[model samples]
Target: MGKLKLLIVDDVEDNRLVLRAICKKLENFEIKEAEDGLEAVEITQDWLPDIILMDVMMPKMDGYEASKIIKNLYPQTVIIVVTAVTDPNMQKNMSEIGVDTYIHKPIDKELILFKLQSIGASIRLKQGQFKTLSKKNALNPFNSDIRSFRIIFDITDTESMMDFGMWLFDQCADKDVVACGRLDLIVELFYKLMRQGMKNQENLSIIVEESYEEIYITIKFENIIVLEPRMVDILNAFESEFIVQKNILCAKLKKYIEEKNSNFEAERTTLTEETIQEIVELKIVKEIHTAPSKERELLRQSFTQKTCAADYVSDIGGDIVDEILDLASLDEEWRERLTTFEEIPSDDNLKKFANGVLDVYAHTINSLFEFTALAYALTSLGIFLKEKAHMVVQDPAKIKTLIMLLENLGYDLVAWRKHIFELQDTLDIHYLDSSFFSSCMQIEGIMSNKEIDVDDDNDMEFF
Candidate 1:
């Protein structure tokens, strides 16, 4: 294994040297340094250190702002704030920004060693879990003949469900099928079917069949309540809505293009003939398509290029949720309101402040990495509820309502996840240095003004 990477970000050279000396005494560490938060962000873009020791107060950018961007983009990377400030408010702000731990300025060697060792052990345990899951079921999917495999398990057994899903990806890996995003899709489909009470002999079967041209998957069970008709209607409605939205977007783009062309033509008399011809050629070459029919086929081809299934599923769930949320525009209003809160009139300041508080809640949930887990948990919950509805609910209307509610909940989770991602993206993209600090200051002010007490009961919603 490669040496674990560590980055020390402090404006004071002596402080960085102190951390560096301590890290040098540690085993298997590759150390790097950055003078301030701006440099730290730049280094992280390429170096992507496993851990960062950051100073809170610095020139150009502060630790809290930098930590927010780094945590948003690389949620897995651990951050420890090494600063002189020991105020409760500072600690609370650091915690909110997703700093893993805090270390005092006058650092102790034993304390540093202990923290490093503890964090290292945790990282190793997570790695062990991944390896165990990947190697649990050693099945090969690459048999020369058309290959098929099926597994039946109780819908209530979440451990088995997760194991089977991992096993399928393991088989794909062994067979060199590169099944990351594809595996996630298969798992989601199984979860969806199971939620509709697909059970045979009190168990559901996940079947995988591979052919020369394609792989086909089926989730089946006896006496399953087939809600295909209603499902089809819902999907068709979503598709129709999507088409309408796409047409509107395309129309807007076309109008904008026409206006630009008119403006360009007005300025044509000032241009040379050759320049005009070149501009016309460039415009023709840059023809745009709002909705391409071949996009799905193109995506399939792109998937064929990936080699590792384990690596692919790592971000597929988050990516899908992000895409869905952006398309639905469910969280756009909150994002806009929070981002532009200061610009709002004093009369509307109260409402904007409330929106900002909700935005903070969204941020807090995201920093906890609850959304990803919630996505999977909701799937399991949906499946469990469907089984109950199947056995106890005699009324078809109740069953339908229950299923629809589950679907809506699933969508809501996606939207929630999407907003969190977008908020982070906005910070990373639009508020790089001073702007980032401004935003963080605003958030800190809001947080300081309110005596927000989030108890376990209130926090349960995120889970």
Candidate 2:
């Protein structure tokens, strides 16, 4: 980590000096002075200082307003208030407005240094989270009004999560029908990656700059641990222009936001509401179909050059859900039967579960040429259970193992189908390889009394 950027905000020149002197004594921070809260906010816009020493008593935008605005915009930046105000209510107000901590006006060198050091240590530990300006991204910090969010976003908030990708899909999908499902799926996957990357952190965030023509997003993350190579390949497939340095993924999404010129605007002779509605709808449809063929091409291209996909894992960028749907409609019978077997791990229940899986795979999925390997694996597992159902039911530990594997594959199968078939736009292809194959091998190992190194530390390098 580089020198910690500190912004000292105080109306009084001497107070600024005193704080600067204290910070200088530490010999660590790269300090800058702000005469008032307003200047502090303005400086924060571009500089994005690591920490701020804000004074409550300031002219032209007090500390309360400054703190609120700064914290709302850049929640990652730590703000510590320096004030003489001893009232509990005043302190409470500062805390409410997002002052990280406070020091008495008669500054204690030790106390202030302690706070700075403590916060600085934490900042250094989570080092890769700092967003650096990337050349590939077109977000002009001096000009663009970037909306920085440090939010606790839930993964399930598919409709509600407001990020560049979701905003692109939900807000603009009506304009371009091609961009709807695919764009939404890719974005939702990115968000899931964000959640996984920042699972250990208290807050996850991405800086967004929206304009009429483009969306520039600076995603600050510690890591994206792509456990499954298939998911890494899928994630790497996003065609957006992104520059990943350390952990910050700065991406630029373009071409969709620009409005295409419409002759319908002028051709409408009538001032009636219906005519206006017709014009708007026609324009949106035109944008979707005619104008964004180029946009579709941009999104359709597999962006990332590198992937963890193995040589034999040749068939990728496939529509597995569509394939399954074409073969057979996903009934909950197989999944339900698996669950039933878990409740009663008897020979009959196990046989029923095996039969359910075999029935689904042999009848529907066996015809798919691309997924023949998966078909074989699943069928083999089914046959394994059907042949050894009595033996499997006798061992509780072995039953437990089979149950875990079946339940995971079952959950993933259900989730993938639901996301793709329903109005939702999230899907995972990792199940085709990692989840399905691992479970198959492990269960077969358990049945044959052979050791399987299921937890192989396979690494996939991702930028």
Candidate 3:
């Protein structure tokens, strides 16, 4: 694509000057200046700039009215709004008006540059060079410039969930880590819901859409989701991760693609709910989840009042898990200890491994949303390792596998903490319970050809 034609629309001369200086840092933009939203629309009618940086509190005509008029006039033009930190309603108002994105006051240069660069790349994707669906699809950006893909899968069973995950990996594996990571975050949220046995026969629809400097992962749930803060209220989730409505939950990841010779990065921005509504086109049934917390957690959530066909799967309790504390530092401690076990397979190291895992089990039990799967898996590994420390130290090869399994087990625990516990991510943690515990059983058979049973009674005996 040619250089991005950018228009900076701010009534204040100083504000326009500063934005001009920042836009100068990026070489791709062929820039312009619009004194107000009216001038912006006038310029669009005559010159048609690719992107517009609009100011909300303008004199002649405000950005809210201007953006709506321009979107209706030329649906293809991208309008990025500027909002003050003091005004809480400015962003929400702009979103309702259908502006592509909003940049907060005390404007950061890096963020603006990233946004422009991403818009430029999406323009490239729109022209039939990269992946292209029909020009009129509800999910795909249709103004001949939006870049995105959609996936619809029913989370009714394990087999379907696995297929959904593998398919997602296939589509996003080639994209950047941020792209894959953000999508994984979305999957984690879905997995937590499905693991709770909320199996609606109607498939959950997800659209991974990219806009100027931002990526949107919007999921449409078949049934209404109910969430009331039990403890800590997660604030500003709308800015970084997810903005939850009733059935449709929108999660986002910020990205800025720096064009390096031939390669480019991935990016995202906000999309109007009307656009989001096109995904499943379900009517509004308000069930709210209002949390604005620094450390995001799903204290308690459930599905309700699903109006699917009679044959369609019904709602179940989606008891989302909340973390007691961060596991990074603790997980790091065990990670180094695993390396130590590799160097010298000693009983001391073995005890450390067992205790370390058991410590995680303790945390899992105390979480508001119960996870017995984790309880059993962590306890079984910890107790079994405590008993077999002597035997494991004797065999180097067996200890190697033990160390490997332990490493994976610790990694999964932290993954749950970071992905599932902290932010929403992939559902792999659900499968990890069976897989990791089964590996622990293999360790048991290797030691004494004995079958070990794990239950609430802590009734585990060896031959």
TM-score of each: 0.30, 0.30, 0.37
Model 2's lDDT to the true fold?
0.55
The list of candidate 2 runs beyond 4 A from truth reads 128-463
User: Is candidate 2 or 3 superior in TM-score?
Assistant: 3
Clashes of each: 0, 1, 13
For candidate 1, the lDDT comes to: 0.45
lDDT of 3 by residue, 362-408 (tens): 54443321243345345555666777788878887778766776676
Candidate 1 structure quality by residue, lDDT tens digits, 1-463: 5577889999999888888988888777789999999999999999999889889889999888888788766656778778766576766555544466666656767556545644544454445633343222323333222123212234445454554544443343223232222222233334445555524334554434222212334444555335456344433433321111110100000101221112223433465554466468447533321112132122122111212322322433475444544434434544454345334323243244333433333333322221322221322232233233223234444434333433344344443444344433221211111221222222222323433222213312221
Q: Show model 1 residue runs off by greater than 4 Å.
A: 127-463
Displacement of the residue 94 alpha carbon in candidate 2, Å: 2.4
- Taking all chains together, the TM-score of candidate 1 against the true structure is 0.30
- Model 1 residue 83 CA deviation (Å) reads 2.0
The C-alpha local distance difference test score for the whole of candidate 3 amounts to: 0.53
Reference-based lDDT, residue 88, model 3: 41
For model 2, what is the alpha-carbon lDDT of residue 378? 63
Q: Lowest-scoring 10 consecutive residues by lDDT in candidate 3?
A: 293-302
lDDT of each: 0.45, 0.55, 0.53
